[model samples]
Target: MDKDKSIDHQLRATWQAVAKMYNEQAANYGSTMAMAFVLLTIDKENGTPSTALGPLMGMEPTSLSRILKSMEDKGAISREKNPEDGRSVIIKLTAYGLEMRKFSKSHVYQFNNVVREYVTEKELDSFFKVTSTINKLIADKEIYNAISQDK
Candidate 1:
């Protein structure tokens, strides 16, 4: 089978391209794509629990720790002891972080608008359906069990 016809190949290639473009654009604001993504995931008003951040953003603890530290050093976020949970910390956006988040939000909106301009609503619906099916398959462990059965 041709690699170009593979769904995994197409998905991986498309995502890599998207990440590169986003990182390039983020560089203009003195940020990286990951930083921008973390900023956007944070709640503007209320703080998010440090433990929940990893799962929420699908980031590894080590990687997220580095990003959080860098953001703190840059005055983008503040970590405070959780009032409700003594064992946990809350990640809050600094005033400057809110400003950066606004830009991140705008960038996301611009990307969506550009995609909408090129793709029809019907096409987006179909794309969503495919992605949803893929996610369901993974969540149900169909792919994992399928390979295990052949062993």
Candidate 2:
């Protein structure tokens, strides 16, 4: 394989390993990595609508709404109808959600440390830039599809 292809394969393998690690610990964390990030995003934004979280998590709106309902029922979050837009409901973390955030932070820090041990800072920076570019490209494709579908 070409050098670039080899590196790409390695990067994917590394991501898979990281995902497996998260899955193994998800029960202890009370959420998957994706769910944890959704909570963190809501925390950062103070609140986020269920609609927005779905797109951010790359999940269908109905599926995300179901998950959010479960979280609310579990006392991890609260959802309120957005006064300005009744069609969208905003989510806020409860005390339990805040505690989960603290736990996730430590785990994330440890994960970063492990990655740092394997890849130099400069290499990681470059890798992130490339990954971001790829994300942007994919996002644009999604946007285009949405726009086309509205016709």
Root-mean-square deviation of every model: 1.3, 5.6
* lDDT (Cα) of model 1: 0.93
32-71, model 1: which lDDT tens digit per residue?
8998999999888898999999999999999999999989
Q: How does candidate 2 score on lDDT?
A: 0.77
Clashes of each: 0, 0
Instruction: Show pairs that collide, candidate 1.
Output: none
Number of clashes found in candidate 1: 0
Candidate 1 segments exceeding 4 Å error: 147-151
lDDT of 2 by residue, 1-151 (tens): 8766786688788889988787666668667776666666784446877778876777887777777777777788888899889988889888888887777777788888998999999999998998888788677797468688999
Position 110, candidate 2: lDDT: 85
